[model samples]
Target: MSTAALITLVRSGGNQLRRRVLLSSRLLQDDRQVTSTCNSSTSEPRCSRFDPDGSGRPATWDSFGIWDNRIDEPILLPPSIKYGKPIPKISLENVGCASQIGKRKENEDRFDFAQLTDEVLYFAVYDGHGGPAAADFCHTHMEKCITDLLPKEKNLETVLTLAFLAIDKAFSSHARLSADATLLTSGTTATVALLRDGIELVVASVGDSRAILCRKGKPMKLTIDHTPERKDEKERIKKCGGFVAWNSLGQPHVNGRLAMTRSIGDLDLKTSGVIAEPETKRIKLHHADDSFLVLTTDGINFMVNSQEICDFVNQCHDPNEAAHAVTEQAIQYGTEDNSTAVVVPFGAWGKYKNSEINFSFSRSFTSSGRWA
Candidate 1:
């Protein structure tokens, strides 16, 4: 009786040990599989941020120092503390901006970038015509208007549209208060971008200022010019008693005045369908493919097309360098308007850089004056 009881206890203990061994083996095997996947050359590349170490350092998007020497603005903090995960640091130091007066007596192009909320960032460019008043007002007030609306509105597109319309109304009121009645004619093309959670990109634009995204060495335009050349825009203008007339260069203008069918602070042409309503586009960013986002006024756009700009920026080492290169190139290409460019780096900032060089010996069509 004693021998049989002892044997039964031993057998039970053996079974428990076997079960523990099997479970440990399975756990170890799962870990090995993950390691293999991360290290495998055939498998998709892995981001170093997710490959954690015990160092406890926060993830960062760029190591580049502060871009501007004049303004000592703070760099953006990582979202890890708020999001409960290691989100990349989106720093203003990594962003680039450049502006030139070009042939204009005074630069009417304005651009800015800022951290709007914990999870959102703002970038914008404004091209003013008739005067710099509209661009100046937008550059100063656009971010504040969007920030004020964010607590009440979650949809960025709606916030941008409302902000634009509100700014237009406010500008009209401000103009009415001024002794100068001609402020009503001051108008600007506004292009604004909001980047949320380092992925969601929403852009709102009125007139011809553009926002372009570069993904995998390719350019994806985020805005369409609000010109009378577009059949839909032309029809809308006509319905509002506005007529489209072309200049000597075949560039169409609304009511033979404003070049764009939509803009901010064009109170004098309000009845002629030059509205302040913005067209918005939202995109989910893929960090592995998306390199950067660039916002430009027509000065750069008219002289250097999107692809050319993308290639030009791709050759640069950092966002700040890229911004200067694009705008400088525009001036070199003979743009007579005030030129401005802002470059914001993304996850693939240095990943998809262009190794091949490009050359442009031919003068720009505008400079050559061969409108044919």
Candidate 2:
């Protein structure tokens, strides 16, 4: 296979292979410390400790390894569906697997949502690259920033822009800790979506995480990936005194450090103009065509596309089941990163709202029939 193909395979398939190797090796041998060297000489600050010859102990788990353990913990989400006209029914799921790389556990991803009022639904997905701090921060603060921007009229575009800026400011301020403070080098890609009046959807994003809308049997992309090697992204990086380099794997990375143009909380790279503010977009929801929304990190994109996921969801009767299947597929295909997904069905709002109409009991739907 070509170098590019090999790199893609390693990224997509390496996690599971690595996990099996690690587990089997541990079972056969009592030592848990497995040392491996990266192909690149210029290592990311976060992964440096994992480098065999680096200053840190040879066996110390790197960010990726640390993340593997973190993924075993259950995902936490804020309260949602408080009060909304035609309240939306939400379903989300996440899973972690070690598929390809035998060395470190690097991928981290999360999603959270909150219903601030009767007309607005705020949600966000964070895909961590170097570590989990950035994604975790986004998951915690996304709702607050978005809700702060919501006006009486509910303009998603304006709110998204303001929210992105606010998040950047918040991250910058947090990064300015004293030199003696202990800090972990971490960052994450983020995407935020807001649904208003049950029709308008607004999305804002930075880095490689994505948001997709399934409308009229067609999948539409709502956010752009700010990859380092993309022409526009390259230009922006070069303008900011940074250079993109091709690693032994032939993948584009910023100064052999990062792979994206925008992200949240890479304190080390912030000086190179890697801002956390997201690019924003707005779209009107269509009832006749719109079916569901899929939000995920780069793990899903490594093996499949939006259409593939949409088709999988089409086969399922329940959104939650669809989410489980998608995560399973990502694992089977070899996504090295911690795979996380949030699936939201479009038409479930009507049923959810109807339940609220009758206060005596809460109604739910099953594959066979509706239940009261």
Candidate 3:
């Protein structure tokens, strides 16, 4: 058989299997509904099949306990196919971002989020150092580079990897065209994520920027910092004939310059083991347990831990408020750096309410409201 024909046949079989699983879930839900109905009187309303409490009302999208009544948004496709019930769509309208200059002379952080394709959503955070040129370039071309590779690559992981390398090469060409030697030194931390079919999440990151997920009121870090502080990263740098040195603040730097082992630019440091290659991760999202994806630059990450950020978000009404709250709080805590945060609500957003969170302003912040 031809390759295209075989690919079509495989997809057809996958669809059939999905349909079978969905049908089974529906049958199970129908049986529960019947039992719940039979157990109650005609005047009493039936509770939701997924409802933890026996509330006497039919389950709406709100039954997931994710959304606020103010939004009243309806569920989109894909996710419903699996649950045999409605789950609210993860929309661009629900994505939120906040960026602040803080004590920096220039705000060097950049972030973007949007629907990249019909089935994929894109989100990224770039923390620029030395200059904003690299971050700015990435902010403009990263999405396009990823979309260009999506048609050729079936796996999202490969797509992200190729996109990162492509964008890094593109930045080098751009820097050369600008005729600015300083642009070569400009580098940025890139943490990019793609959500496909509302089920698969793929994240690729370099440098110290991070992508974190909130699942069932807890924090799950999706990316790790690619810094000389990591033993493997340090060893890799040493193998490349590079050395690690500590700054006055005791932060390790590769070759006594760049703090990270990987980045998007910094052409001068490329030979010293500061590479553009990113560490990538892919995960299957569980809508019922996964609440949102939060992307942050080291500015906020250095000041606020992932659990603290997650709890703060859980206390907010929506993604927009959550993003602003986290960045603002980082500044309030005396971070002398640019602070930026992007919050993308998933199927389980707002499921954990304010009452569920035990956050204290004094607990995370120091007595002088400074970074401790």
Which candidate number would show the highest lDDT if scored against the true structure?
3
Tell me the tens digit of each residue's lDDT in model 2 across 14-86.
Answer: 2444644653443334222332343433453323323435444333111221112211221111211212112
lDDT of 3 by residue, 1-372 (tens): 234422332233223345335434644675587766676666655444444355643333343333333333444444445534334556788898999998789999999987888888999999999899999999999988988898999899899889889988999998988878899899999999998876779999999999999988889999999988799999989988899999998988888889899999998888877888888999887766788899999888887889889989888988899999999888766687899999988867777655655545674566233535
Give me the candidate number with maximum TM-score. 3
Cα TM-score per model: 0.78, 0.64, 0.81
Pairs of residues clashing in candidate 1: none
All models: lDDT?
Answer: 0.78, 0.60, 0.80
The collision pairs in model 3 are none
* Model 2 ranges off by over 4 Å: 1-107, 152-154, 178-184, 348-372
Per-prediction backbone clash count: 0, 17, 0
Predicted structure 3: lDDT: 0.80
lDDT of model 3 at position 246: 96
lDDT of 1 by residue, 1-372 (tens): 134422332233223344235434544554566666665563454323323452423322222111112212222233332332223345788899999998779998999999998889999999999989999999999989999999999999999999999999999999989998778899999999998876679999999999999988899999999999999999999999989999988989987888899999888899988889999999977655677899999999888999998999988888899999999898777788889999988756767667786656466544634432
